[model samples]
Target: MKINDILTLYDKILIGFVIILSLILLLIPFYYFGSPAEGEELILKVQQGDELIKTVAVADSYDEPIVFEVEGPIGIHTIEVNQGRVRVQEAPADDPLKICEKTGWVDREGPIIVCVPNSLSLWLESTNSDIDGMSW
Candidate 1:
């Protein structure tokens, strides 16, 4: 075919592809991410050497959990806050895995506390906190 005819055919194909792609894109948000809804609260507590540190209210914005690192007389610690519960866990002694420890506490709408070294964790998903998101 002539170059002009070829160009016209290409343009028609491109237009058809764009229309199909646009329809597919419109359906993605509803199926993949869904509607944007308010995140639930996640409360967490860390205890070390007789002192307890509670995390401030963590707002829901990101899908990933909020990570909090604590250092005290007991040693280094990591906390993960998601939904409305806190996951408090002990840091590894040797070749520690801070990220893995943080991932250990993953709850959709509850607390999944884990203290690896101390073998202590308070997981209360149904329980309500004093300040909705405050861990005490």
Candidate 2:
């Protein structure tokens, strides 16, 4: 083939190769880390005046602590649980400048309960089966 004809053929092949590479790159994330496999189970429990009240379970299995929010009569509460540990604290009662306390605990993935002046919450994390957040 002539030089010009060879060049045109090469251009088409290069373009096709680029398109395929781009598509493969886009799919790599979905294949590797897009959907994380189930992680360890985490459970949080809350108590009120010596009474067990609320419980929350993190569905996705993860090694890192997951932050969640709880609301009570006094104000909003922020909690973080990970590796069978629980951290509960008071948050701002109003909007704008809310802060969370640093009280935390650690235990097996079974029952973690907390009480905020009569208001209570609980978290239950399990690794035996697949549990969703709603199950909490």
TM-scores of all candidate predictions against the true structure: 0.36, 0.37
lDDT of 1 at 42: 38
- What ranges in model 2 sit over 4 Å off? 1-42, 45-63, 91-103, 109-112, 116-118, 123-136
Candidate 1 — which residues are off by over 4 angstroms?
Answer: 1-40, 60-65, 82-90, 94-103, 108-136
For residues 24-94, what per-residue lDDT tens digits would candidate 2 score against the true structure?
Answer: 99999557433324665444556555565556665432566677776666666777666545666445455
- For 33-121, candidate 1 gives per-residue lDDT tens digits of 33223443433444543456554554441466667776543466666566644555446564255443565644433334545444444
Q: Rate the local accuracy (lDDT) of all candidates.
A: 0.51, 0.55
Score candidate 1 by lDDT. 0.51
